[model samples]
Target: MSAERVHRTTHDVTVAAPAGVVYGLISDAVQWPLYFPPNVHVEQLEFDGERERLRMWATANGEVKSWTSRRVLDAVARRVEFRQELPARPVRSMGGTWIVEPLGADRCKLTLLHDFTVDGDDPGAVAWVERATDTNSTAELANIKALAERWANLDELVLTFEDSVRVNGPAELVYDFLHRVADWPELVPHVSRLDVVEEEPGVQVMSMDTLTADGSSHTTESVRVCFPDAGRIVYKQTATPLLMSAHTGEWTVEQDETGATVVSRHSVVLREENIERVLGEGATVAAARRYVREALGRNSTATMNLAKSHAENAVTVL
Candidate 1:
C-alpha cells in the first residue's frame, strides 16, 4: 500500500487475456464503463496527447454523484492512476491504481489499489463511501478480469488456410516484391489500408490498420525488410492497441534447387508487456513462447500461404 494516509483499499484479480490486450482495454478510459457496472460513466474534458482530465458519474442510493478526475498513465510500468478533483461531496479526495502481472503464458494477475480521504466536514459519510468503494472495487476487478479472459479465448476463433506455388523468377525478385510492403493492399483482400510512415536505410516502419475477418479494425505499427541472400523478408509489429511496448516476429525464405522458394514465417517473441498482462506470475520466457505458438500458429500458416501466392504470381508476371 502507498504510504499516503488517505482511505486505502486494494483488490486483485486474474484475467486470461494477453497483458497487452487487458492493458489496452483499461487504458482506454472512454471504454471503462463498457465492462464495469451500469452506474459508471467516463467523460473527457481535455486531453493533451498524454494525460486526460475527465469526469465520472455514478448513482449512489438513487442520488446522482459526480466527480472530476485526472487520469495519468505510466506506460513502462503498465499502471493507470486516477486522482479526484471536483464535485467534492463529503469525499474530499480520491485516487486508485491498476497493476498487471504475468501469471502464465495465457493468464495474468491484476491488482487495484484505491486510496481516498473523507472530507473533515463529513467523516461518517466518507466512511460509508469507503465501505461501498471497497465492495464495488472487488466486483469491478472481477468483472475486468472476466472481460480480458473472454478475449484471450479468441485463440480458438482463429482459422488458417495454407498453400504454396512455385515462382519461376529469382528468389531476389520474389523477395523484393515482398519487400515493397506498401503494395500489400493491392494484393491482400482484407487489407484495405497501408500507410508507410518511415523508410530508412535498412528498415521500414509503417502504420497498419487492418479489418479483421469479422469486419473489426485493429491498428498497429509494423516494420519489414528483405534479405535477398537468404531469400527471406520479415515483418514485425512494433506497437500495440494500448501499451507502448513492441511486439514482433520474422519470416524466412529458402529457395529449393528447382528454383521454387519455401517461405515460412517463424513466430518469434511475444511482447513482454503482453506476457505480463496475460500471465501475471509464474510465467517464463519458454512458457510464453509455447502459449504464443499454440494461440497464433494457425495464423502463421495462413500468412505464409498469402506470401506464397504473391511471390508465385509476381514471378510469373516477371
Candidate 2:
C-alpha cells in the first residue's frame, strides 16, 4: 500500500507577556472554549502530571467536530506537544506543538505547529483539512496575543459563577427541559425568541434572543454538546452581547437522596471597551461586572425555577 501524504503548517504571533503566561494559556485545554473562538468544549479524560488526555469539540469549516488527543506539557521549556488519538473525519492523523520563546521580561513569541494526513489522501479532503487548520490556528494565535497582552487586567476581565436549585423530581425531566431549548420562548418569560438545530445527535446549534430588565433584547448564537447519561450540557456562545467578549456555560443535574439538584454555571470575559457604551457614561468595570452577574443570574435562576416546576409537576401528574 502507498504511504499517505502528510501536510505541515506553522503559525505564530508575538505576545506582550511573559513566556510563562503564554505557556499557561496553551497548557490549559479545559479553558480553550473561553479563550479560543473555534473551541466549543474540552473534557480532560486523564492526567498524570506532565501528560494528559483530552476530548475536544470545535468547529472546522463551520462544522462541529469532536476528537480525542494526548498532550505532553513542559513548563520549563514552555512547550506542549499534542497528538490526536482519534482524529475526526477527513483527518487520519494529526499532531501539533506549541512553543513559547521568551523575547524579554514581558514579551514572548508564541508559535503553533501542525502536521496531519488525510484519511485517503484525497485532494478534496486534504484541501478541507488545510483550510480548517489554517483558519483555527490563525484565530487561536490572535486570541492568545490579545489575552496575553492584557495580562494585568485578566482578573477583572474574566468571571465565573454558578446558580443552582433543588428539585423534587427526576433528573431526566430537568435535563429534558434544558435540552429542548426551542421551547424556551414559550416556557421561559425572559427568552423572547430561540431557534435550535441538531445536525448531529447531541450537538445543537442555536440562536436566542433574550430580554433584559429594561425591555431591551440581545441575540446570541451558541453551540451546545449534551451528555444524556451524565445529565450535563456544555455550551459556548459564538456570538455574544456587547458587554461580553466571550461566554461559556454548563447545565448539570445530579440525583440525590431527596430528588435532584440542577445547576447552571457561567463564565464570561468582559469587553472592557463596551462597558460604558452599554451601561452608561460613568460605568466602571466593577459596575459592569455587577450588572452582568445580576442579569445572567436572574435569567439562569428563572430557567432553573421553571425546570424545577416542570419536573415537579410531571411527578405530581404521574
Candidate 3:
C-alpha cells in the first residue's frame, strides 16, 4: 500500500472550574498558550468592541503536522467556535465547545466537546479516525480536568478558609453581600488588610495581610477570587514558595423550604515541591488531610464570626 491517506482526531476534557470561568479563560485568546502549552500561538485580529476574532497556530506531536485556525466567540452562550484556515496532513475539519453548568450552590461541571472530520478516499484512514476519537477524547478530558483542577487547587498554599454559618437572612441577599472583599478588613479580625489587586467582571485577584499572635505579620499575594453571582464567592491562594499545601474553597448561601445555611467548603492539596520539606516522603496522606482540616477550622466560627456578621448585615442593608 502507498502512503496512507491522512485522518482526523478529536479530544475533549471536563474541568472543575465554573463554566463561565473556563469559557472566559479559553476565549481570552491571550491565555490560550498558557493552557495548551508552547505548541500553540494565539493572536487577536479584530474587535467589534464585544467579541474579537482570534488566529491560532497549533503544532501536532511531530513535524508531520501543523495548522492555523480562526476562532470566534459566542459571548452570550459562553462558547468558542473554530474553523481551520489551512489543513495540514490529516485534519479536514476541527472545532469544539467549552461548556459550564451549575451542579449546586458552590460547584459547577465543565465539559469540552470537540469534533473532527477525516478526508481522503481511503476507507481505513477514515475508520481509524472514527475509532480513535473515543479514546483520544477520554484522555483529553482527563488532562483538561487535571489542569483546571490543579490551577485552582494551587491557590491554597498560604490561606485556606471555609466554614458554615446560620444567618437569619435570605440566601440571595447573603450571597450578594459576601461578594465584596473590601469589607473583610473591617469585619474579620486577624484579617488586618484586604485589597483587590484587579477586577475583571466576575473574577478578581485579592491581596491579604494576616497578623500572628506574636505581633509578626505574614503577607500573601495573588489570590484567585471569583464572584459567581450574588450569593457565592470562591477563592484559592495563588502558588507561592512559602506554601506547602494549597486549598480552594467557596462561600455559598442556600435557602430551601426548611431553612438556609451559608456553606463554605474547600479542597486542599499538597504541592510536590514542598512534599519533602513539610511532610516527609513517608508521611501518610491522612496526616496532610488533618493539617488542612485544622487550618480550615482556624478560620471558622470564632475566627470568621465577623464575616458571618458582615454577610448578615449586608443582607439587612441591601
Candidate 4:
C-alpha cells in the first residue's frame, strides 16, 4: 500500500514587538479566546510547566469544532510545538509549530506551520481541512501581530470584570435558568428579543437584541458552549457592540454551604476608533473602559439577579 498523503502549509507575519512578548502571547493558550478571533475557548487540562495539554474550541469556516492538543513550550527559543491529540472530523492527524524569531530589539518574525492528513485521504476532506487550517492560521498570525505590536497599550484596550449573586436555592435550578437562554426574552427585562439555535447538543448559536439604559437596542450574535454538570457556560460574541471589537464571557454557578452563587464574567476588547463616535467627542480610552464596564456589568447583574429569583422562586413555589 502507498503511504498516506499529508498536507503541509506555513503562515508567517512580521510583528513589531519583542520575540519574548510574541512567544508569551502564543504560549498562553488559556487567554487565546480573548486575543484570537477564531478561538472560542481553551481549557488547560494538564500542565507541567513546559509541556501541557489543552482542550480547545474554535470556529472553522463558521462552524464550531473542538479538539484536544498536546503542547511543548520553549521560552528560551521562543518556540512552541503542538499536536492535536484528537483531531476533529475530516482530519486524521494535525500538528504544528510556532516559531518567533527576533529580527531586532523590538521586532520579531512569527511563523506557523501545519501538517495534517485527512480521514480516508478523500479529496473533499483534504480540501476542507486545508481551508480550515489556512483560515485559522492566517487569522491567528494576524491577531498575534496586531496584539504584539500594541503590547504597550493592551491594558487600555482589554477590559475584564465579573458580577455575581447568591441564590437561595439549588445550583441545578440556577444552571437550568442560564442554560435555557431561549426563554430570556420573557424572563429577562433587558433582553428585548432573542433567537437561539442548538444544532449540536450543548452548543448554541444565539442572536439577541438588548435594550440599553437609554432605551436603544443593539443586536449581537454569539456562540455558547454549556457544561451542565459543571454549571458553567462560556460564550464568544461574534458580533459586538459599537464600542467593542471582541467580547467573551462566562456564567458559572457554585454551590456552597448556604446556597448557590451565580457569577457572570466578561472580557472585552475596546474599539479605540469608535470611542469618540460612540461616546461623543473628547472621550478617552479610560472613559470608554468605564462606559463598557458599567454597561456590561449592569446587564450581567440584571441577569444574575433574575436567575437568582428564578431559582429561589421555583423552590418557594414547589
Candidate 5:
C-alpha cells in the first residue's frame, strides 16, 4: 500500500459564448482529440445518459499515458465530475470536475478542478503531477474558449464529417481490415506505400503515402488506437497538410442481425493563413471546408468500399 497525499489544482477562463456550447464540448469525450492537444484519443467503454466509463490516452510530461475514468454528467448544473478507475504509476488517485457558469446572454466561465494524490510521500512525484495538471488545465481552458467564441465569427476552425457504407460481412472482418493498416498499400489503390509499427499491443504508429486525384501523393503520420471488441479504430494525425492545423478520425464497424456497416469520421482544424495559399486566392473557411470534404472524404469513401469488398468477399471463407 502507498501513502496518500492529496494535491489540488484549478483553472478557469471566461469565454464570449454561452454556457451550453462550452458544456457540450466538455461533455463529448470522443471529440476531445479534435479539440484538446493533450488528449490523443478517447475510448467509450460504457455509457448511459448520465454515467460513462472511458479509457483515454493523452500526452503528459512529454510521454504518452493512459487511464480509465468514470464520469457523472450533471446536465442540470452544467457540471461534470470524473475519477480515474485505473490510475497510472506514481498516481494513487486522480479526479476532477468541470463547471460552466453563464455570465450573461453571451458570456460564460469554465472552471476545471483537478485533485490528485501520488503514491507514498514522494515529493518528486507530487511535483510532477502538479505540473502536468496545471499545464493540461490551462491548455484545455484556452482551447475551449477559442473554439466556442469562434462560431460567432463564422470562422469555425475545426470541421467534422461522417460517412458509412453497408458491408455484407462480419463486423470482426471489417474491424480487422482497418486494424491491419500496413496492408492498405496492397489493398487500397490510392495507397502507394504504407508502414505500421505496433510498439504496444492495440496501439500503432502508422505512416502512409496516398496518391491524389492529380497523380501526386501526400504522406501522413498518425497514432491509432484499436478496440477489437467494439470494432472501432481511432486515429489522430501527427503530420498533416499545410492547410490543416490538426486532423483526427475514426473507423467503426457496427453489427446487427442483418449485417454490418462500416462508418468513417473525419475531423479537421484548418489553418486560416494557408487557406488562400494552398486552396487558391480568396479562399475562406467555407472553401476550406469544402476542400476537406472532397479531398479527405474521397479517401475515406475509397477505404470504406475497399474494406467492404475484402471483408464481404472473404465472408464465405469464414
Candidate 6:
C-alpha cells in the first residue's frame, strides 16, 4: 500500500492577487495551455463531481511528453491532487498536489508539491526530476501570478481574432465539413499536410502543416474536443507559431433562417522577447499584432471559404 522508495520536491510562490483567480486557473485543466507555459494540450476524458480523468501533453525538461492523469478536486479546500495512471519509465509512482492559500485581501500563496520514487537512487534520473520539478512548478506559479495581476488588461498580452463565412446550406453540412480536418490537405489550398489521431471517440490529436501567404511554413500540433450536438469543436495548440507563445481556439457552427455560419476563433498570446528576432529588429508589439492578425486571418478566411464551398455544393443529410 506504500511506495518502496520516495523522493519529494515543493515549490511555493506568493502572488498579489485573490486566491480564487489563481485557483480558477489551476482548476480548469482544459485551459492550462492558455495559462501555463509548458502545457500544450489537456483533454478531459471523464468527470464526475470531484473525480476526473484527463490526458495531458506538456513539455518537461525541454522535451514533450504525454500522460494520462487521475485527479481529485477539492474546491472547498482550494486543493487538487493528481497521479499518473501509468507512471513513466524509471519511476515506480508519481503524484502531486496543488494548494492555494489566501494570505489576505488581494493576496495569495500558491504551492506545488511532487512526490515520487524511482527504482533506485540513479543520479541521472533523480537530477532530471529535480530540474523538471523546479522548472515547471516555478513556471506555472509565475504565469498564474502575472495573468492574475493583469487579468483586467490582458488584451494587451492576449488577442482573439476570428473569421466567419455564411454557407447557403444546412448547418449539418457545414459542421461536417469543418469537423473533417483530415480532408483539409486535399480540400484546402493552404493546408499542405494534416494528420489526425483519434485514440478515443470525440477526442483527437492533430498535426497540421500550413503555408501562409508569404510562403513561410510552420507545423503545429493540437488536441481537439468535439461536440457534435452543439456543432462546436474546441482545440488547443500544443505547438505554437513563432509569434505566439501559446494558442487556443475553437470552431463553431451557428444556424439561422438564412443559412449556417462557420467561424474560426483563434486566441493567441505573443512572445514579447522573440518579437524583434522573429519580425526583424525594431519590431514593436503593435507591429507584431498587425502582422499576426493578417497572417492568421488569411488562413482562417481561406478555410472558411473552403468550407462554405463544400457546404453549398454538397447534399445535406440533415
Top candidate on lDDT is 2
Better of 3 and 6 by TM-score: 6
lDDT per residue (tens digit) for residues 1-318 in model 1: 333246778788878767777777678875454345422446688888668899765444323456798988776677888888884566767888888787777777788888777656356776677766866677678767766666744333222222244555456555665666688778655567788743234446678766654576778765554456776554445455432122334455557666665444332323344655665676654566555554345444555556666666665442
In candidate 3, what are the lDDT values of residues 104-220, reduced to their tens digit?
Answer: 533456555656655654566466545544554464455445555655553433233467777665666555556666776776677799887443465556677876445656675
Task: RMSD for all candidates, in order, please.
Answer: 16.6, 1.1, 15.4, 1.3, 3.5, 5.6
Angstrom error at residue 183, model 1? 58
Measured against the true structure, the TM-scores of the candidates, in listed sequence, are: 0.45, 0.98, 0.45, 0.97, 0.81, 0.68
Tens-digit lDDT string for candidate 6 (154-253): 6777888898887888788878878899898999889899999886577677999999877978999887778799998877787887788788888889
> How much lDDT does each candidate structure score?
0.60, 0.96, 0.54, 0.92, 0.87, 0.84
Sort the predicted structures by lDDT, highest score first: 2, 4, 5, 6, 1, 3
State the displacement of the C-alpha of residue 91, model 6, in Å, after optimal TM-score superposition: 14
Evaluation by TM-score, superior candidate among 1 and 4: 4
| Clashes within 3 Å, all models in order | 15, 0, 10, 0, 0, 0
Off by over 4 Å in 6: 1-9, 13-31, 37-97, 100-109, 114-139, 145-154, 316-318
lDDT of predicted model 2: 0.96
What TM-score should be assigned to candidate 5? 0.81
Model 4 lDDT per residue over 100-209, tens place: 99999999899999999986689998888889888999988988888888899988899999988988999999999899999999999999999999989999999999
